[model samples]
Target: MNTITRLFDFPYHQLEKYNLSDSLVTKYGNDWIKTSTEEYLDKANAISRSLVRLGVNKDDKIALISSSNRTEWHICDIGILQTGAQNVPIYPTITSEDYEYILNHSESIYCFISDSEVFEKINAIRKNVPTLKEIYSFNEVEGCKNWKELLTLGEDKDNQNIVEERKNSIATTDLATIIYTSGTTGRPKGVMLTHQNIVSDVLMSAVRVPLRAGDTRALSFLPICHIFERMLIYLYQYYGISIYFAESIEKISDNLKEVHPHVMSVVPRLLEKVYDKIYAKGDALTGIKKKLFFWALALGMDYKPYGENGAWYEFKLKIARKLIFSKWQEGLGGELELLVCGSAALQTRLSKVFCAANIPVMEGYGLTETSPVISVNDMRNGGFRVGSVGKVIDGVKVKIAEDGEILCQGPNVMIGYYKDETQTNDVIKDGYFHTGDIGEIDQDGFLKITDRKKEMFKTSGGKYIAPQVLENTFKQSRFIDQIMVIGDGEKMPAAFIQPNFDFLKEWGSRKKIAIGSTNKEIVSNEKVISRIQEEVDASNANFGNWEKIKRFELTPDIWSIEAGHLTPTMKLKRKIIKEIYKDLYHKIYS
Candidate 1:
């Protein structure tokens, strides 16, 4: 509403408003080459025009299946908007079953696939989707329309006007995108977010983080298909921040070195893995270097920020930053100012560890329903607090129900689940969206999320247990990679652990135990079992009796996308695991 409505109407059009001439670079090998934002926009416009030429009209749905990238993928996203069509992005790693369901369910008229490999999968199942009309592959493939060729169709002036007509007709309340939730429990439901929902988020997030023009730059990697990443795309554009797309997750370290981006957003799983990598590397250091690393880590824990009246702690923290944290900074390409984390609860220890390292890791909390952000720690305003998702963002009203469920009412909240009116009314009651998250507010107004209402379970002893809280605590232990606390409608909670097998394998070799063995053999070994048990026991001490994990079992293979144990977002599919491993649970309890 700032009166700058001419260049583009959609959220993706925000790119044209700011630094259209600035460098928008994507990674290639070790090089960071610049491509003008205008050039990127022109390509997008061409695609948009082409879609119009293909007879795509307002309110049409276009499916986008791809991974995180900087260049062409972004163009396709913008093109979807320019045509006044809804973008339905599916994860590149999505299962064939889900892919078929999403395509057929959404009635997508067209789809843009990332590469030939992805195109092949869709082509195999394309016949199943009766509504799908055209297929465009980002990378060239046989028998498919190339992405560049599609752009040529829009080059005609008449085609361009059709796209413009569609854009002019779009209302603020019109659906901008349909993001299907990759739920850990059930079939994925498409969440309909409007232009208003995302626009509100862009403004509110800026209020909390202050991504001022020319001051902030973001390195995008988290799948833009998810609300958490998608919302930030709008935020970055609205504030005129430079947006750089990372080449891949593997190249983040290198990309950070090159871009030195001030801000980035990620989930807890990625952060934990990065922290683990740093720890693993730190273990290789010897003598003073190793001792210094631990000393710096401890120093970070003790360092208190300014305005907290901890003068003594602040002074000590400064010395620690100089001595121990400086090297840690160097490893991260040295210029990270703030990291906004969401999707799952970040381990408090991880947040503190990064903060101690002089990089402010601000943890935030929200679901896809609330445009994915309601609260986040404000680094500039308040000292980042551990175990809290900061204060709620401005313009968002939060109230805790008598049952302790968190309810949020704001423009940022989604309109409702697409095509599911029953669910829509059931969750959004009396102008408030029931977040289904339990939380409490402190005197300082920082929100501490306690548990998920749906994920909580009761033990056979009639004691209530919240698995998420316990899982966060358990993850603090480096030995445990991922855990699912299960004892639902049972006597007591137990866990199915996916151990840090690499760490265990290394330990076995070091101790001269049977090293070259299968995962089952290694896990069953007395030494490995004892080591895992010690960590589990330590975690259990903080939990109430029935909530404590008892008699855990370990699986050798890593639970991964290929195995379907985890979603593309890396969240465990609990019900799937429960069904697959029912025998394992029965064996432990019976």
Candidate 2:
């Protein structure tokens, strides 16, 4: 196999060549409904041919703005690529303002929207976006050339040459996709990744945990707009893996059980929520079940670190898995080989607990600028490390800078943020792409991320505090679901916490507090705040005095994507949180 391929080159060709899809029929059956490989190639060729008919040429930007649906998304994406045009994907959840900004900023001439909602959204702002020349819809909507209709126009004999010529025009270093990340900072900046960047990442990641012909079921729910999931999509195809598109975020668990996937790429917040759900269920268990649940977790947490081959605590874990955690496994469909987590730092305790439960949760690290994956814990091949994001994959080089910021140099690193030369220069220096995160490599070469260099804050007492470390400690409390540590130039460290309402609501009922109170009133209650204060104080004991959270305020609402406190990838935008709840922090210190 060639070690590298151009983005415009057909990746699905490799799948067919390898004959790995033969067993896919047996594994997925009719549920694996995708635009078949032949159809995909035909559709892609047709679309590329049509784009040529429309006078689209190499390097012309084509934007795909839609939700993650299997067929239309691929048709447009492959179409755009096969035409030698750069594909820009926008999350359907983005606002009208952001949509307009990306359309004009990328200077996209051709755009494919999913449904009428997207059509209406763009149409409402189209008059203002001069760069947008045409709008195509996936479904037949009023006043638009449907996607299939556009492809039909390219049936001329000469169109095949257009597809071939377009493919040949693409180079490995040419821009493949421009993913816009609305990071914690101001407006979103376009992260430009080339064909070599992501394809290399996908192949390299496969080395750490080889994707075999039999081991190939995946539940695709994470937004392909994000690099982590996007890279996996190509990697799955590269490995001839059969992917099952999840219906939506709401149906992931059901989809997981139905797909019974061998592997999944997830974010830490999802894992944390799953752990909380299991813990909540355990809390409901009676007598023996309840005793067994805590006992297993305690054993996992207290057990000495065992390398991959060692099973010092396996005897206790085996009993625990059989008696208590087996039902939990059943809930996840029992066929999960590994769960990979990244996009944010996972609490070490939570990682420790899940791995102990025999559900191997391999935590990793990366940023959007780095083609989104720098390091991930090796699933079962290399000896696993509990607290780190495993070893760097082959072909990727990582080094800690003087101040602990992770610097990366690899084929996977983005070509730099699109069109923002000044800002791009600030981040990508020399050959290394500076990931604004801070971390240190352990003696074993596993990367343990401490905090974001940009997010680390100082208190008025002249003490530097890494809020992520403190926040991770607080997540262990089980009562505090999400917290934003804010002590930047303040007298002492204080925090705005979003309590686990499910846990609190249950606690409230047991204590006979009013059941129907608003979340704000519930969290603000003297008793509830005092209880959480004890949790903070307990968490503080584990950290150095300067790093401890001294005082905190609880918020009624959870920090979420819709709430704007968290990014879509589940990373907390601390500045946004602090700005949103400035009064709460002020009141706490006052």
Candidate 3:
């Protein structure tokens, strides 16, 4: 059980012993900000000294509210850790009330905000949080202290010894971070994680998928507040890979081309969007090019990764690769070797299409409480099973409970939920953390998640339906952008559908159907409904009569994080969706 103390100590030692400097580059606007390893270490040490001068001590909690992924974010995080204080990350998208709750609960003394907007969020609730002493803004603010002031405060050379002593005094078991889960069910609970929990995951995951220094470049777009990306930042530094942060969510595609990164981690929603864009482009092609594009796509979707296809299928695949798939790779900046997808189950059809096009998508599964890397597909050895989240990482053990819930045991598991022993006990029992995800391990050691235990519901006929499974199946249709199956306490299943507007527009022109501009009119149109019914019927053909969706309601409104229908990671907030569409659900049942 090695700890992150050694991991944290490496940068300084690299500066002193190996003369390693200016290796990390972060993107700011159109310019790249390059910081030497030594420079970063010095700045972090200075910030640490400043915090001590501000009366911050070991075990104190410091909160950060930021949407940007500048080098300063990493420096502040390491600086807080160097002082043996815990870092509490707050999502910038969260409401002011959530900020108050987390800051008050953690008793954070100092808060760092990325911009004025974030500062305003904290400022609104600053009076409510009695423990908060100061708010530092990374960007210039009229009333708030800028983050650079800390460096000026720490200029005294005498504080160097104090910084070193504090770093050495911190133990691996000491709390390093307290990440609050973005609750779908209730109030957000802070999951306490030690250096041991996170470092073990980084080390084990590195062993599973070896990322080399000087060879791997990563473009980061996922929020640093997320454990998935936070852990990845450490892994990138450990492997000596240069990381380029995208300016914003909208700039990811442009950044990917400019960075030409070797590897990237993304949520499935982004991947889905990429596929949708590609499909839209394919649909826009004409004549021979259009026919060939679709033919290649069909062949790609039927591709078998393990070479299980017949000679005829293999022959067509080679032609598809040459004629169409190579363009897909080129479109993704021509250097992407591995695309790591998580945060939700990727549609298996989409997975096959990408892999078939030589763009390997490695889907993994984990939770924030596990320091996020539980299992990931092995890209090097071809250990990928299309629908399965690859083998559990080294040093982690997983088992299926009698009720089919996935239970995990590893050093990577969190210590407990902060100040909630009862809630912690409910999940962790006899050293195994109950994941609350229903899954089973195959003979090949791949784990396939069936559904969320809480999400699976039984109909009035006693037949259980996994909404995710049904939704995923329906989403394979080109016309469907999103689908949510509903059948709780009902005789059969129904769905709320969001049509793919691009596909529908093209379809409408081809069929001479007048699609209304408004969502209500579009959904109520007989022609649109009939087309959606066709797709639903095709999807239902694969399921039993009890499992099939008998009716559906279409919506024109897109689900988005800003709209409160989706989480930051783009996962549907099911309870919120159910509540918002209660009338629609009743209409389907009626």
**Candidate number with greatest TM-score:** 3
The residue pairs that clash in candidate 3, if any, are 22-36
User: Candidate 1, residues 329-419: lDDT per residue as tens digits?
Assistant: 7777677777888878888777877887778888888888888789988777563678899998889999999988999999889988877
RMSD of each: 2.3, 2.8, 2.1
Compute the lDDT of residue 343 as modeled in candidate 3.
Answer: 90
Question: Candidate 1 local accuracy as lDDT?
Answer: 0.79
Superposition error at 353 for model 2 (Å): 2.4
TM-scores, all models, native as reference: 0.94, 0.93, 0.95
| Candidate 2 lDDT trough over 10 residues, lowest sum | 21-30
State which candidate, 2 or 3, has the greater lDDT: 3
In the range 1-590, model 2's lDDT, one tens digit per residue, is 45448653434545455444321221122365544556666667788788889999888899887665455676668778877789998887777888889988899998988778888888988998998999988766898768777777877658687678778778888888899987445678999988888777777787775456534677777887788887777767666666677767787787778778877778888888888888888888899878888898787675434543357567777787788767777778777767778888887777777776677787777777777678888656555777788888778899999999989998888888887888898988988888888999888788888888888887888888898888888888878989888878888888899998888888889888764478978876888878888898898999887777878888878787877887778878777788889899779888
The clash count of every prediction, one per candidate, is: 0, 0, 1
TM-score of structure candidate 1: 0.94
Runs in model 2 lying further than 4 Å from the true structure: 1-3, 8-10, 18-32, 140-145, 155-157, 183-185, 303-312
lDDT of 3 by residue, 1-590 (tens): 12245336545544544333444677765688888777888888889999988889999999988886777888899889999999999888987888899999999999999998898888999999999999998889989999999988987768778888988898878899999986544778999999989988888887766566645678887889999988888877776677777788888777878888888888888888888899889988999999999999998878777677988888888899899998888888788888888899998988899988888888999999999888999766767888999999989999999999999999999999999998899999999999989999998899999999988999999999998888888887888988888889999889888888778878888888898767677878889899889999999999998999999998778877877788888888888888888899889988
| Cα lDDT, model 1, residue 560 | 77
